[model samples]
Target: MLNALDNLTRLISFDSVSKNSNEPISDYVSSLLEELNFEVERTTYMDARGVLKCNLLACRRPLSSHPKLDETQSSSASDEETSPKNAPGGLAYFCHTDTVTADRWTGPGGDPFSAIVLDGRVYGRGACDMKGSLVAFLDAARKTPHEEQKLPLWIACTADEEVGFEGARFLTENSNAYTELVAADPVSIIGEPTMLHVIHAHKGICGMQIRSQGHAAHSSTDMGVNANVAMVPMLQTLLEIHNRCLTDEALRNDAFDPPTLTWNFGVSDGMKTVNIVPDHSNAWASMRTMPGVDGKDIIEQVKRRADELGLTFTLYSGGDPMHTDAEAPFIREFCELASTYIGPNSPEAVCYATDACAFGQLQHRVVCGPGSISQAHTTDEFIEIEQLETGIRFYEDTIRRWCC
Candidate 1:
């Protein structure tokens, strides 16, 4: 059987960047799932740039569909005990197939896609955040035969996660596996780089842009409407709001580190020369939304300020904050497993968002996996070899605990 490292090496070779089509990587994953006798659902969509992207949802035992019982699976357990009705839930693992841009890769090698093993680590883009985590789940799925699954074992690889989770949003409506996974209400995992630590909740993602338009003219003519000048009021308003987010206790929660919305925005102008007046300027901002906080309230405040300044305010995207009660049964049980395998551990809250935000229907979802968030998207991204083995074992144990 191929180990996680073996599989990750091949997977890292693919440049599944956010701006490019993920068909190639998705195809390879689809092939692997098929070879494992998994029932696969492939969903495709055209990105904003009209590039084709793909999402894959594969199950070892697809809900009420099971075939060809492995003798080993049956020998250890009775058929009655193996009935789907007896099994309360299965496991669902979520990962993104797309990675961030690797144009700045400056590791030992020039090729970011060419994965290398050095100093007991695997180096490459997405190695930790998280093709490595994905491969670990794949290894576990490979070991867990379909015939042995008393419940479903789901694996979802979404596209465009680096670019606002577009594929996850797409599959939330289009994929049958997503439909079934939601209906199953199984405990789901968003396999980001958590260093194998469980994450109970994470902040959501939201952004808006305020644009000011004006006519360009020579500076000497004084006939041009400088968009930058018109944006002054909005800039002041944003600064005020930004400070509130940073310091206002009422606008924050203690459950998350930094607790605040962590809102940030930047101003940009298209002006080229000092002699010419700028015709266009815009301010784009994003906030990491938290639960119990009305992020929209802040957004509306910004919008109203733009209206007062006679500027256009556009809310471009919003992914709801992912939260599951840390006291939930599934979480407690998972913690117990963590204690046994990875030592004493508690569910943590991360500042970053994951695909879980889009598939918010799965209330029991948690974000956890190998590698560290610090290593994610770094110029020399890598995962320690130790994490790969431990991640595989943890996933295998989780699969057996829930499915077998």
Candidate 2:
């Protein structure tokens, strides 16, 4: 527990904010992995401004097949089926090393990066949102018996998960560190704040922006068309679309709370002054589509509706929703391991999104970790001491079950 807390403190102090360069924290993680007798592969790439950003792929040396499993074992019998010797097909843990901006932190005393402990809770940015999981994973690796870990154990510490999935996108496309890992399609555990619950299904997110244009003229003139007025009906149409999605039985997925597509117009802009007719207006909306809902179809519907209103629309960005077989053995085994401490609980469907949505594209993935998602990105973010200890033990047990 103390070792895990120490690593968490060290990690939180680095201030690896999403908009800043992650070189320092990346180097620190690489150094720590090296000290644990793991070979580190750092995949470096330049961001839009040519600043260096990196993702670290570290795996235990002498990666091997499942020596602990019997030779006659089948894939149905165990999630860690035997693979070619030294192949990357085995247990892997994923976590984003970058954190959201801490400028909004309103906690008393020390700032977000102070890594302070108050009343059995560690207060800091990214403490619960995820630096704690990384620390727990590292500490667990340090305590694992070398001989017990017979299969490959890999860690992917990625960047740019907050603003965009660029880090994960780059790693999957360009990195050679885990070609076999992807090919083998190993069970992946994404460490996100889930209150130690196993998440097997969640909605995917995508966004679009609609811009309205009109000729600008003074209010006293009759030649002007109001972009704001043109946009109002389109906005109402979007609400109608939302209402339609809510009523569409075919678009429902019971796993999610609303069981339907959810949309929010997060940003809307128009005229700056009341006297002048606005020439331009735009609304940025986010859509969270349930798994099995065709995001492209939704976009097409919006496009057609916009065409009826004579409005131009653009898809700024978005990510697909993801789902893993709820009955997968790996998920069952993971939940079983967690149940030992926290008692039995079933896999849940969460509304929150994570890097798991990105990694789930390549493999079977589940999101589980200590702390609550409610605390993530809050002004006073924190992780309880008890949860941290439980997380360390959970990670240690996971390594033993899959690697050993």
Q: Using lDDT as the measure, which candidate wins?
A: 1
Q: What tens-digit string does per-residue lDDT give for candidate 2 at 285-310?
A: 77787787855777887788778888
- TM-scores, one per candidate: 0.93, 0.89
Task: Give the alpha carbon lDDT tens digit for every residue of 1-404 in model 1.
Answer: 46678789889999998988999999998988888877889999999889999999987784455443332322221113345443335788999999999999997677899999999999998899889999998898887766777767788999999999899999998987777677666668888988778899999989999999988899999799999988988888889989889888888989999899998999999666898889989998899988888577888898998888889999976689988888766787788887766789998898899888898777668888988899999999999988988888889888988887
Q: Provide the lowest-lDDT 10-residue window in model 1.
A: 71-80
Candidate 1 stretches with Cα past 4 Å from truth are 62-88
lDDT at position 156, candidate 2: 90
lDDT of each: 0.84, 0.78
Which residue pairs in candidate 1 collide? 196-369
